[model samples]
Target: MLSDLQRETRDEEIWKIKILSEMQRLKISFYFWREKTNNNLSYTSLMGPDKLKILKEFDLSAVFQSKTRAEQIRALWNQFYKLYLLMQNKTTTKKIFCHESQAWLDAFLAPSTGHPNKNNFVRGMYRTQDVTPYIHVLVNHVGEFLEIHQEFGLAAFSCSAVEKKNHMQVCLYFQNTLKDGGHENSQKSAILEMLEHENQQLYFALNETPNFFEAPKKFRLE
Candidate 1:
């Protein structure tokens, strides 16, 4: 078993994972990695399978493409950001995406509807690229936030509103202006628990190479 400090560290990583998962659930476009037992490295998507299930459940055929999903998510997160601002009693024209972290931000805002207990199925590849995707764990929400924006093109993110419920303060970035992702969830508590406890210690450190996407030669948005 791990010691107190070790357990604490591990727990932190768990919370980070939860947060990453949340980003994925939010439909944030990002990828991640982990230091397995030395040789068992792996990477995965964040778009959440439930999204597909949701599409099937509601007969949503338009969300099958990757880019479409990305756009939808960007919009929802904007709304969440606005609400977060109201709770914080802060006023700013800047948006949240510009300041969000690399994979973390992508994953945090990945979910289209913030639905907890759902798989976001985040698209994108994974690799080792320093300064590409940021890194972090739990107990350092602010640091984590900073780390994300430190990456390539996210330095313009602006923390807007604060989420207040039951007297609890949750600094948020609910982007609602744009309509991109297909459809997702909105479980605030679940997302909170994941970011603060479950997915902590999960670092989104730098990689040698950044995940890239390929453009389709033909148009088929029917």
Candidate 2:
């Protein structure tokens, strides 16, 4: 069961995947460049006020000019990569898909792991070398997410009870309904209903005891 925040993160990932697929399709057809003449007016004006507002929030801008096709693609990738990191504001180094180091064996048993007889050291060393450039890029791009995750210890928060309970109820409802010839649309409706019920339960519980976190009440010195 994913918490509301996790669901938001998943939705963002889905949106990024769609955007990246479109970019890849364009890249294959050389759509980002203009043949015969070096003009980028369309690119510069591609995103109007709404997009500019979003870019301003993250200190990002569309690169409308590049000397080479490779540079243009690289710029696009960099922009999307930064956007991805910004959206996923609580990711760990282990979760970084592109350039994660695999040095667990070496860390645990350095002398034995680094021996010539063992190939673990060789594989780990080469993998590190191959991804060195990407590692640098990730470090520069995702520093904000890393910093926030570390500062807040976001991973410490487990899936909320309300979310898990709702998930279980929905799953049970789906399974029971399936036996009665329930369809996909019905399953979705059932899940939504379960979620609504859980939400109301949470609202009532919070109303009954507002200080759920047990925060200390302030007292006047006078």
Candidate 3:
């Protein structure tokens, strides 16, 4: 059912083209706008739904409060990445919070050892500014990840990571429009051209061997 271009390309390659590329562009632009304006702009802000049901396998209703399910997942991954970076930092002098944060990180790292999924029931923790209650958020995130892997393929995680990145781009493009004296229509076309050009340049820079995450071999695609 795949076209020649689609068939020849690996799943991750196809994912890059169809998802990551666009998401990265948009997310970058969005972050630029936020930096320039110092305002928090998000997909939920522009669009009413904080999350969207891109795929309809699991019930995300429990995790989401203000954001939609998809948005919640994006927030979770954002937190996960931030936590991951924090954990990876090998600085000499550690903060007090770092000690507590490690325990949280361990919980995320070891989701199988405890009954995190059944005990907690919060999915939309990303909507808050506080990081103290991250355990609940982490539990929801891991639960969602496992559920998604069980029902869909590992490609779904790839898809999600790409989308999370994509959220930044369109906002950045808006900032470009502001910089160009609010020529919305003309600036949009110009930005699109510029994005395509840069994308091509970056593609060659990657040396044509796109790095991809390993697929979870044990999970069956539902």
lDDT of 3 by residue, 1-222 (tens): 112223334553443344334435344221112334666422322231212222222222322232343354454455555554443333312342345445545533432233457744433222223334556544335434434444453333445566665665665555533433436575546466547645765786788744455877797788
Model 1 stretches astray by more than 4 angstroms: 1-32, 38-65, 90-222
Per-residue CA lDDT of model 2 for 66-179, tens digit only, reads: 123223334444554454444345545434522322222122122323567764442121233334554554545444445555555434544478778777776767663343
Q: What's the best-to-worst order under lDDT? A: 2, 3, 1
RMSD of each: 25.0, 24.4, 24.6
lDDT of 1 by residue, 1-222 (tens): 012223335454553454456546656554446566675434454243643432323211122224544344444345434334432332221233334323334444343343445665443322234112223321124333434444432235433333233223222223321122333673344445435531232332233333444886997897
Task: Output the TM-score of candidate 1.
Answer: 0.18
In candidate 3, which residue ranges exceed 4 Å CA deviation? 1-128, 132-137, 151-156, 159-175, 179-222
Collision count of model 1 = 78
Q: Per-candidate TM vs. native? A: 0.18, 0.21, 0.20
Question: What lDDT does the true structure give each of the candidates?
Answer: 0.37, 0.42, 0.41
Q: Give model 2's clash tally.
A: 0
Ten-residue stretch with the least lDDT total in model 1: 56-65
Prediction 3 TM-score vs. true: 0.20
